[model samples]
Target: MKHWTEDLDDDGDEPLVRPYTITGGRTTAGRDDLTLITLITAQSSSGTDTSAERHALQPEHRTVLRMCGRRPVAVAEIAAELDLPVSVTKILISDLIDAGRVSARPPLAFAQNGALPDMTLLEAVRDGLRQL
Candidate 1:
């Protein structure tokens, strides 16, 4: 018999679950520190033994971890990648942080005491985006 998801797409792609279900019906993130540009990274390094904990996470949480596994990613980017609203994405990320699955921090420009970002750094970022 064909799988349930096969009927949803000709290419067998899975359907996206409702955003509310993904966030467990909650409306707000556990922490208030998250912002659109906040950087998030997975805590599981190459040799880390977090498989047991990993197995307990929800599928959406796993997806977030995988997306940020390689490098620090902005929250806005994560939201876009997950195809979920920014609010929902923040809640999911907050859950991961609470479970020690991932960590988050403000971007370098925002880390300073309300100081503006360096022009050279901004230019470099623009160049990188252009390359992408």
Candidate 2:
């Protein structure tokens, strides 16, 4: 029996979902099964009915489910694997924690040791893009 959580990103900036199996919740033996999910919300936006977005399990969650299944993992490792900034990961993880979908420590320690590149990196990236 194992539980894992993953933060998956969509095409846009806003995060989509992290699939998980909560212990003692369902699927018996307190073991959560690896299951795929699809969501559909009947809400409309700007007078237009938007279809639900589809996202696969994020790499972090996929790794969690594959390895730990029910073990706890640090947010730092998760963000590292996903190659996302700690602040963004923190926000996503926060939502997951609030939703009871994932377990995480507070204060977002993962953000402490993180380093964000200055304009140099951005310029380099931009320069490279210009070359292409």
Error of 1 at 120 (Å): 14
| Candidate 1, run of 10 with poorest lDDT | 7-16
TM-score for predicted model 1 compared with the true structure: 0.69
Q: Tell me each candidate's TM-score.
A: 0.69, 0.31
lDDT of 2 at 91: 47
Predicted model with the maximum lDDT: 1
Could you say which candidate leads in TM-score?
1
Name every residue pair that clashes in candidate 2.
2-69, 3-69, 3-70, 6-61
Residue-level error in angstroms, candidate 1, position 59: 1.8
Worst 10 residues of 2 by lDDT: 34-43
